[model samples]
Target: MKQFWDFGMEQAKSCIFPVVIFLSLAITKVIHLSLIARYDLILIICLVTQVLMVVTKRETWDEVKVICVFHLIGLALELYKTHMGSWAYPEEAWTKISGVPLYSGFMYASVASYMCQAWRRFDITLGNWPSTWVVCALSAGIYFNFYTDHFIYDFRWVLKVATLIIFHRTVVYFTVNDRTYKMPVALSFVLIGFFIWVAENIATFFSAWQYPNQEQGWHLVGIGKMSSWLLLVIVSFMIVATLKHVKGKMKQAPKLKTEKTSF
Candidate 1:
């Protein structure tokens, strides 16, 4: 019971920033800020929060860089998706560019932020990670599918199969209050994806963005989006793993399993 409690608390601590940001965005819609639009306010809050994380050492500089990568990657997708009519921001703001508020990218960055913070806070490690090239290629393929699927045959299922093959043996390890815990890496992605889907519903409810069908009124985002989020989680995880998980000559070791972080 104590272990479960501690684990839950640790999860909550790791989730603080994302949860707070989402709820604050939802709540901010109710408050009228005279000079600034709600979307602009969100952007300001996100930037300040990111700076504060580094200022207080809640996140390291490397982690911040990883988060920035997520931001840019996400913004690129947002630009394309918005152009393709995937979804849209209904409100007007000075930060809007091609119908996407700059702050929207932070939603993706928040996931990386959570992952990095959770990794350090929980002394997380990985085992049986697939080859760097294979994982990187899979990440790239998944990302490409997000755009190319609209124009040609969707290869998401094929990519999903490839991911399963590569990650079949991968496991994530972490410590919670001195007792070690482990989970299949794929399962973690699915769990996180589901929660992100839930958050998406909430974001839409608060008018963060709307789909074609949602223009009339808010409705649940299709269940299919969870699959997309799962793939995205993999991409985000791989990028951060490249920075934090890969280190030194451990790459040369055969069957690299245990992490070197002296946990």
Candidate 2:
């Protein structure tokens, strides 16, 4: 127990900056800030964490660089939309402003990238295929972007979602890594996704959180949660396929088995 506690303490040391900054901000104010200001903490931590990550894991820099760039690209795209006022962060995090919070977008991605890699490594070393599936599934599902209240008339997000669903898979098929689009990963992503849906319904119903565009026919638990999830699965597979093709790895593709396995 003492050894366990010591290891935890070391882990905490690694996250000191993020922990302190986020806690201070959380205490100072959670809502009411403009999007940019609200996310100042996030931005600060991301920059700091990125620095620390390089300092500690100098060897894995190549792998880190890939995801970091991918994530940053996504952030830039979001920034463009936010700047155009196509979508606004109506809920202020205790600061006053309109665009999406800066820290939220950038830092969250940093943390998520690290977490997914850690989770992936963990699975590869011990749990074999199941662990990898869990990591990929959960990561992809969250990024699937279905619950974005796509029907919200404010930004025509619904239209964007529709357009993406129709065309995004093609983009993914050309962009993401090849070893990614498979049944184990897809199923894991699907199950966790439904779990999240179930959780969100509970939250919305209880008023713990609000879904502003609940009136949309796609909300499932609002309109089409299942359909949205299906779209997500397709996109994730496409992303993996595209990535594989880009690396000239599609020539020898492995089949994704959907059969039930006995543990």
Candidate 3:
């Protein structure tokens, strides 16, 4: 029994990323209708796994702090947007957009755990100069509002394949950078999420886009969601900050012997 437990842990440690992917896919499927129902269990499993691993690590304080910033920022932004009627998801997941349930935080963390791992493997860095824009543009191209809100839930099969490919490549490219200051990078993900939040609100305001059943997602304050657009640039700066910190650390050299000789 102990050996079996050890084996399981080893496998989990060795291939947690693949496990996360498998978990998200398995979670996203829930046929009988409700958004959180049938689909919520997968989120639990994914988060439980990350929690176990994160607890085992000693240096998680900074990471947790950054994630908390994301959570607060997300909640505030969502509450602000809830006033606008810009976008919505199945209300089953939330009693109020202003008060998104706690599970939402866990959901973000679960996906974020996988993203941190992927970014490390991709070697993608703000240090790459203009290449950083490529990541954002590509993410927008693939994760377009229309597809995730409508297509993935119903016509999931089509999305499954494309997502698998794109997500795999994205993880690979981003995870390539070994010298990473994790907190900033994680915050960038949160910032990106915020950008998406604002973007959806804008589209809905213009009547350029709308989701079929969701009513719990899009919300901004009296200001148009466009007001939050600057967050995207902030996110980019955060990424660059992480790159600069990591690069500086790497370039720091150990002290060498220096002596004053006596005659």
Per lDDT, the best of the predicted structures is: 1
Q: Positional deviation of 196 in candidate 3, in angstroms?
A: 9.1
In the range 115-150, model 2's lDDT, one tens digit per residue, is 334333322111112233443454454454433444
lDDT of each: 0.84, 0.41, 0.40
Q: Using TM-score, give the best candidate's number.
A: 1
Query: Which scores greater on TM-score, model 2 or model 3?
Result: 2
TM-score of 3: 0.39
Per-model C-alpha RMSD:
3.9, 10.9, 15.1
| Estimated TM-score for each candidate | 0.92, 0.43, 0.39
Q: Compared with the true structure, what per-residue lDDT tens digits does model 1 show for residues 120-194?
A: 887777878877888788899999999999999999889878888888888777777665666888888889999
| Colliding residue pairs in candidate 1 | none
The better candidate by TM-score, 1 or 2, is: 1
lDDT of 2 at 199: 44
lDDT of 3 by residue, 2-58 (tens): 534653454345446334535454435423445454324444654565566668762
Q: Order the numbered candidates by lDDT, best leading.
A: 1, 2, 3
